[model samples]
Target: MLSICARHCVLWSIGRCANGCRTRTSHSSPRFPKSRSPTALPPMLKPSVRSAHSREYLGTWGISNGAQPGLFTGTCEGPRCDASGPEKGYTPHARVQQGFLRLLVRAQSALVQRSHHKRRNCAISGARFKRAREVVMASYIKRTIRLNPSQARTLSGFANRRGLSEYALLLKVIDAGFLALLHGTDRETDLAEMASVIGSISERLAERGTSREEASAAEKQIAALDTREAKSHADHKSLRADWRATAEAKGFGEAAQARAIAEAKERARAGELAASPEILAARAVAWAAAKLSERQAVFPASTLAREAGDYAFGRLSHNAISAAIAEAGERGALVPRAYLDRRGAESAGFTTPEAIATEQAMLRLEAAGRGVSVPLASSLAAARTVERAARQSARAGFAWTDDQKRATSALLTSRDRVAAVQGYAGTAKTTTVLATYAREAAKSGLTVTALAPTASAATVLGEALGLRGDTVARHLVSPEAKGLGKGAVWIVDEASMLSARDMAALMASADKAGARLVLVGDVRQLGSVGAGAAFAQLQQAGMATAKLANVVRQTNADTREAVMASIEGHAGKALAALERGGGDVIEGASRDARLATMAQRYVALSPTERVRTLVIEPSRDGRDTLTAMIRQQLVQRGELSSAAVRFEALEAKGLTRAETRQAASYAIGDVVRFARDYADKGVTRGSAYRVERIDPDKAAVALKAADGSSVDWRLRQWGAGKVEVFEC
Candidate 1:
C-alpha cells in the first residue's frame, strides 16, 4: 500500500496519471483531455488532512489537496502515459519516481524547519513576531504616502540592501521606528527617575556639606521640566480639540481628518488664504467705508482706496480697490460723486449722502451771504482815504505787489458780505495785503477782526493785522460774537483749511450779524482735515475772488519757481527746480540709514540754520522716526539739554459738531491748551490750563492756569479746532 501510494503521488506530480483526473496546467500551458474513470480510486490515494502551514506552503506550488485525482485508479491513457501500471504493459521508472519522492521530502522538511525557526525566534524576541502578526491582522488600513525623488531613491537602496520588496521594507521600517519611539519614551522616563534620585542625593549632600545653590538649581530644573510637561499636555489637548472641530466642519472622518489637518496647516504657513485677492478686497472695502463714516464725509476715490488698503494691512493694488469700489457702489453702500458721468466717478471722487446735504447747506449759506451787503466804506471819500493809506504803506518799503494791492482794494470796496481772496503760499497775503485791508477797513470805520484755523496761525494773523487773533471755533462761542454787526470786517486766514460745516457756520454768523466776511488763503494748500473742500468748492462756484499769483516770501528765483510749479501740481518740475537750486536729496540703503544721515546733517548745521530748516516728511511715522534720530544726535552733541520733562502730549484731532457738543466727552482735571485768545476772560492762546471742575448741567468748566488763576469757561469754548489736551 505504501508503494502504491508513493507511485500515485509521483504520477500525480508529473500529471500523467489517468483515472478521470483533470490535468493541472500552468496559466500559460495548453489544456489537456481527461481520461474516463473505470472505477473509484484506491482508499489510500484519497485526499488527506494537512496542517494550515503545510497547506499554505504547498499552495504556492499548486498542490492544495494531497495525491490528485487518477493517482491510483490509473486506467492510464494520457499521451505520455504507458497505460501499463501493474496491469498495463508499461510501468513508471524506479529512479525517476524515487528521485521525485526525495525532492518532495526535502521541500516539506525545509518548510517545517522554517516554521520551527520562526517559533523559536518569536520566543527569543519576546513574541515580537506574534505582536507584529496581530497588528497586521487587526489593522487593515491602507495608506498611500508620496515621496520625493530623493526619498524614493533612498528607500529603494535600503530595500535592495536588505533583500526586501519595497512594501515589506516600508512595513519593517515603520515597525522599527514605532518601537524606537516607544523605547525612547521609556528611556526618558527612566532618565527622569534617575534625575529625581540625583536631585534627592544632592539635597541630602547640601544639608551635610555641599553648597545649597547646587541643590536649589537641581530642584529648579526638575520644577521647570514639570511645568514644561504640564504646558505641553495642555497644548496637546487644545490642539486636539481644534483639529476635531476643523475636521467636523470639513465633514472628514477620523482616518482622513489627520491628513486634512496637516494640509490646512501647510496652507496657513504658506499664507494661501490671507494673501488671496478676494480676502484683500473684502477687508479693504469694509475698512474704507468705516473710516469714511467716522471721519471725512467725502474723499478722493483713489486716496480712500489707498487708505483702505493700508487699513486692510495688505496694501492692496489700486485695481483691486477699484473692483471692490465698483461692487460697493452697485450695492448702494457708497456714493460716487463730483463726476460728470458714471465713468468719471472713478477719477472724480466719492461722498456720503450726509456730506452731499452738508455741501448743499454750505451753498445756501454762501448764496445768502452774497445777497446781504456790508459796505466797508460809507462813501467814495472813505474809499479814497483807504487807497491813499495803501499807497503810503507801499511807498514805505513794505510794498504790496499788484496782486496784493488788488486783493486789498477788492476786500475794502466789495459790497457783498462774503469775499474770497485766493492767495498762493508765500504771497504775504496776511502781512501785506490783509494787513493793508485791516488798516484801511479800520480807517473807514469798520472794526477788523482776525481769525485762523489754528492758534499759531491766528496769532500770526493778529500780529500782522494789529488785532486780537482768534480761532473760528473760539469766535463762534465768544460773548462779543453777538455784538458783531454792520461796521465789522472779519478776516479768516487759512480759509482753505475750514471744513464745509465750519465755513457754513462762519457764513451764517456773519450774515446774521450784518458783518463783512473776508476769506484769505491758498486753495492749493492742504485741504480741510475733517471733510469737504469748502474753499475750493466756493472758488469753483465763481465767488468774487482776488488771486495773489506771485509769491514774495521766497526771495530766491529758483525757489519761487519751484513753489509756483508745486502749486500748479507739477511735482516733478518742482523737484527738479529744487535740485537745481542746490537742494540735496539724501538717500541711504534703508529708511533708518537715511534718517541717520539726515539727522547727522541737521546736527552739523548752525543753530540759526537748523531753526530755519523745515524737515517735510509725507507720513507721520517718517516724521517721528526722523525727529527721534535728530533728538538723539542733538543730545550726543550737547546741542540740546539732556534734562527732559516727561508729559503726555495729545495731538489735536478734528471732531465733528456732534462730538463737540457732547458734554459727557469732557472730564474734570483734564489739561487743555487754548488755540485762540479770550482776552475778556484773561485766557491767552497757546496757554495750558487744567480743568478744575466740570458742570455738565450748566455746560461749563472751571479752568485753572499755572499761575493759580481760574476762569469759568463755557463747554462750547472747548470746541474742535480750538483746543488741545495734554496729560502730565
Candidate 2:
C-alpha cells in the first residue's frame, strides 16, 4: 500500500501500490428532473462509509489549498492553526494575562538561547558554547537509519558553502507554487509558462524601446485597456443623444447622408462654399494621416478626419481633397490615409487616395536612389461614368444621347468617325471612361478595344479589366487589341498622351473590325517622352487645341494651386505663387501657408517651361540601377556571375520611363518596396539571377520563394526603390 495526501497538509493517504490515481463509483442521487418511476434507476451503492473528498484513503483534501468559491470549504489546520479549544484535561478558557505570560516566557527562553549560542555557528567559535549549541540542534534533528554518515558529510559540505539547510529548498517550492495560484493557473503549469514568456520579453526589450515618440500614448492605451472606466462610456452615449436631437431640430436629420447634395446646396446659398481656416487645417491632417497609413505607419482616423478638407472658408472641394493625395504621393508625403476614410473606418485596406500618395514617394525614391522605373499607380476610380459609348447603346442605361431618331440603328449603335475624351488628374474623366466601358462591354457581348501609351500603362489598363497582359505594349497599335470583332466598341485609355496617329491607326483597326470608338486619356499625363518623333502624329492632328478648362480636380484655391504645380507643365507658377504668401514651407499647408498658396506669381510660364523649371527631376538612369542591385545581391548569394547590378537612388520629381528602362538593372535576392504598393507587394524580399540570360529592360531572375515566405522572392512584374545591392 502507498500513502497519499489527505485533508491535512501532511501526506496522509493509503492507496493501492505501483501506479497513480484511483477510481470509485459515487453513490449520490441522479441529478436530473425527477421521473415518476423509481424502478427506472439502475442500482444503489452497498451501504458503506464515504469521505467528502475521497474514496477510502484518497481524499480531495488538497482542494482547500485553493478553495474556489462554491468548490470546497476551508479547514482550520496546517500552519497558523492551533487546537480549536481546550478540552478533556485542559481548562475551557484562559485569562488574557495567562496567555501573555506564557508567550513572554517562551520569548525569554528563545532570547537566552540566542544570546548564549549566537556565535556557535560561526567558524572557530568558543569551545563551551559551540558544543552546547550543536547538541541542542542535533537533539531536535535526531533520527535513526536516516542519511548515512558519509551522505551527511556531503550534505554538510553543501550547507557550509551556501549557508542553506534542506528545509530552505522546501520553502522556495512553496513560494513559487503560491504565486502561480494567485495568477489564475495550475501552480506547475503557470510557473513554466511565465518563465517562457519572460524569457522572450527579455530578448525583445531592445526593439520595443527603440523609439519614445509615442511612449506616453502607448502607455496610456495600455493602462486604459487594463482598467475600465464607466463614466466615459455614459458621457459619450449622452453626447450622441444630444447631437442627434440637435441635428433633428435643425432639420439636418442626423449626420448629412449625401455630402455632395449638402455641399452643393450650401455653396449655392452662399454663392461659394469655402471652408474656414481651421477646417482647412483639419483636411490637411486627414490627408496626411491617409498618406501615412499607406506607407504602413497606419493610424486611427478618429485622430484626423474632422480637421480635413476645409470646405467653406478654405475652398476645399471633395475632388480637391482627393487630388491632394496625388500631390502628396509625388512629394513623398507619408500620410496614413487609411485613417481618414468615410465613416472613419480603420480597416486594413489603403483606399486609392492614401495608396496613391505613398506610392508617389516610393516611385520617386526608386528612380532617384536605385535607378528603377516606378510608376505612381493606384486603383484610381472616378465618380461619374463617361457617356460617349454608353449613351449610344440604349441598353446600358445612359441618361441621354444625341437625338438622331431619324437616322438608322447604325447612328444609335456605332459611329463611323472615332470620338476622343481627354482630361488630366481630376475632372472625373477617367472614371467616366471606365464606367462607360464596363457598362457598354456588358451590354454589347462584344470585346472592347483598349490601348495604352507604354507597357506599364498597358498593364494599368489590363488591371482595370482584371487581366495581366502577355506582353507590354508601347502604343495602342500593338497586336493585343486586334481581337475585337465587328460592331464592337473600342476604348483607348490614357488617351491624352496618345498620338493622333496611333488613335487613327486604332480607329482604322477598329473600323476594319466594324467597331465603334471612344478614345480616353489624360492630356496632362503627356503624349511622349519629350520625343519629337513621338508627338508628330499629335502635332499633325492639332488636337492639343482642344482643352477642358473648368478644372475639375481642384475646387479649393490652395489645392488647385498645388495641382497646378503637380501636373507636368503647369507647376512652376503654382509653386511660386504659393510661396509668395502665407504658405509655410515648414508646415506645408498651415493656415498662413494655405493663404499664401492662393497668391499670384509675377510671371506665368508655358506648360513646357513650368514643367522644366518647377519640376526637379534628375536625368533618368542611362542604365538599370535596380537591376544592378539585384544582380549584385545574387552574386553575393553565389547565385549569379553578373552583367552587373547598379544601385541608384533619386529625388527626381518627373523621372522618365525611357531613362528608367535605359538604366534598368537587377540581381537575385534583391529586396524592393514597390512604389505603388507599400504592403501587398510593398516589400519585395526576394530576387536573384543567373547572369548570362536576360534583356536590358528585363531580368530572368530565378523565382527564389513562394508567396508570403518573407525571404527570397522573385517577381514577374516589378519596380525598384533605393537599391541596396549588398544587403538587400
Candidate 3:
C-alpha cells in the first residue's frame, strides 16, 4: 500500500513538472485522475511534495518504474527549493521508500501542529492589537474642523481673554458644549412643565378674580374690624363701670360689689372686648407724654416709641405711637419739635411746653452773653505786639505757623464776651495756638483761667497754658468765678462737651463778671453728651469764631491727609488713605478673632508705640472685651503684672429716674457716683462711694467713702442723672 501510494505520488509529481514534462499511465489513483494532471494537491503534502528532496525521490522512483526521470529532477530549481537531491549512486530501495514515507508523515503532522499554534497566537495578537488601538484612539483624537473667518476670530478672541492656548480653549469649549447638549433636553422639559404649571395656576387665579382687588377688600375688612373692636372695647368698659356703680348704689356689700365688677370685667375680656388700636395708641401717647415730663427734655421719637412698645407689652407699634403723637400735637396736648442730634442730623420728638420754655431761656441767655462784649485790656496794636512778641519768644525749637499766629491774633483782638475757637484734632489747638493766646493775654495784663468739662482735660489745658486748672462744674460753683471781673479771660477747653444747660450757666457767669469767655475745642471730635450741640450751634448762630485749620501734629503726609479727610467728613477717603499709609487694618473670620489679632499686634508694638496708640471702641461691651484681651496678652508677654485687684468701681448704669427710686435697686457693695453735692451727707460731687448697707424698709442706703467714712443717703435722692450706680 505504501509503495502504491508512493508510486501515485511520483506519478502526480512527474505529471506536472515545471519543465513541461508528463507521464502516461493506464491505472490512475483517485487523487490523480487518468486523463488530467494533478493541478490541486492536499494542504498537508503541498510543501513536502514541492521540495527538491521529494522531487529527487520521485525522479528516482520514475526511473526505476521505467518512467521519465529528468521530469522531476530539475523541476525544483528556485529560491523556494534547495537544489541538492539524494546523493549520487544511492539506491531507491523499499526501506528507503518506507523511511521517506515516514519522514513525510511526520513533517505533515508537525506542520499541522504549527498551523494550529499560529492560529491561536494570531487570535491573541489580534485581540491585544485591538485593545491597544482602542486605548490610543480614546486618549486623543485629532480632527480637522472648518470655521468661517468670523468664527475663527471669535475663538481667537476668547482664547486671548481666557489666557489659554487656542487648542486648549477649543477643547474646553467642546467639553462645555457636550455637557450643555446633555443637559439641554432636561432643561427644556423642565421649562415646558413649569410653563404648564404656571398656565394652570393663572387659570385658577383668573377663576377667582384679580388678586389685587381681593387683597384691597381684605384690608378694608380688617380696618373695619379694628374700628368695631375699638368701639366694642370702649362700650364694654363703660357698661362695666355703670354696673359697678349701680350695684354699689343698690346697697350691695363691698365684697359683693367688687365680685360683681370682677365678673363683669371677666365676661368682657372673654368676649370680643380686647384692647384695640385706638386704646393702645392713646396709652402710648400718655406714656410718651409722661416720659417727656419726667425727663424734662425732648427725646428721640423712635426711642420713645420702642419704650412705649415695651410698656404696652408689645401692644403698640411705632406707627401707632407716631400717629398718637401727631394727634396730641394737633389737640395742644403735646408739642412736636425737631433738633439737631449728636450726629448733626435732624431728629423729631415730642416735648412739653415747660421744656420748650426752658430751651428758649437757654437760647436767650446765650444771646445775652453774646450781646455783652468785653473790651481788651490793651489796644489792638498793643495786643498784636504782645502776640508777636510771644510767638518770637516761643519755647526753643517751637515755631508757630501762619495759622497758629492768625488764631492767636483773633483770640487776642476779639471783644465778644463769648468767643469760640474751632480746631480739629491734631491741630495743636491747646498746646500751640491756645498756649500762644494765653501767653499773649497774660503779657497784655489779662488774667487767663483754664477750665474744661473734665478734670483730665483741664489739667492738660492748664499744663499747656501754664495756669491753674479747674473743671467747669467746679469753676461754676467756686468763688474764683465770682472774682472773674474785668481783665480776666476764661479759657474753656473741650467746650464741645458742655451741655446747653451748662453752657448757659457758664455764659451767664462770665457775662455777669465781665469776663471774656473763650470756648476752645473741636466740635467734630466729641459732641455734648447731654442735650445740645452748643459749640456748633453757637458757630452757626453767627458768633465770632476763630478756626485753626492747619493740622500740625501728624508729621507723616499720608496720615495727615487721612486726618484732614476725616475732619472734612470724607470718611471713605480717610479710610482709603489709612490703608495706603500702611495702617493696621486687622481682619479675621469673626469679630472676636479680629479683636484678638489687634490685641496681639498691639502687644507686639514697642512701649512707646503702645502709649501713642489710641483704640476707639464704639460700644462698652466691645471696649471691655478688647481691654480684657489686651491685658491678657500683656500678661503673657510679661509686660503687665499677672496679679489683679478686684474692687467696687462706679460704672454709669444710665437708668431712668423711676428705675432709680426703688430702694431694692440699691445693692450692697455697689458703687455710686454723685453728680451733685450732698454736703449734709458728706458726699461731694463727682465722688464715688461703695454702698455698705441697703435698707429698703427705711428707703435709705449707707455709702462708705474711699476714706472709710460712711454716710446715710436717702434712696429718693439717688435719682437718674443725680447719682450713677455700678454693679460690683
Using all chains and alpha carbons, the TM-scores for the candidates as numbered come to 0.47, 0.25, 0.53
Q: Candidate 1 on 428-536: residue-level lDDT in tens?
A: 7777667767877887788889999999999999988778899999998886566866788889999999988788888878877877888988877877876777998
Residue pairs with backbone atoms closer than 3 Å in model 1 (clashes)? 84-88, 84-89
Q: Give the TM-score of candidate 3.
A: 0.53
**TM-score of candidate 1 relative to the true fold:** 0.47
C-alpha lDDT of residue 532 in model 3: 59
How close to the true structure is residue 586 of candidate 1, measured as C-alpha lDDT?
56
Range of the 10 consecutive residues with the lowest summed lDDT in candidate 3: 148-157
Prediction 3 global C-alpha lDDT: 0.58
lDDT of 3 by residue, 569-650 (tens): 8988898889999985555998898788778887888999988998777887888899999999889888789999876444
Tens-digit lDDT string for candidate 2 (190-295)? 2243223222322333345622222222222223223322221123333456545644555555355446555655564353224453345444754445333323
Candidate 3: Cα lDDT at 473: 93
Q: Please, what is the whole-model Cα lDDT of each candidate in the order they appear?
A: 0.58, 0.34, 0.58
TM-score order of candidates, top first? 3, 1, 2
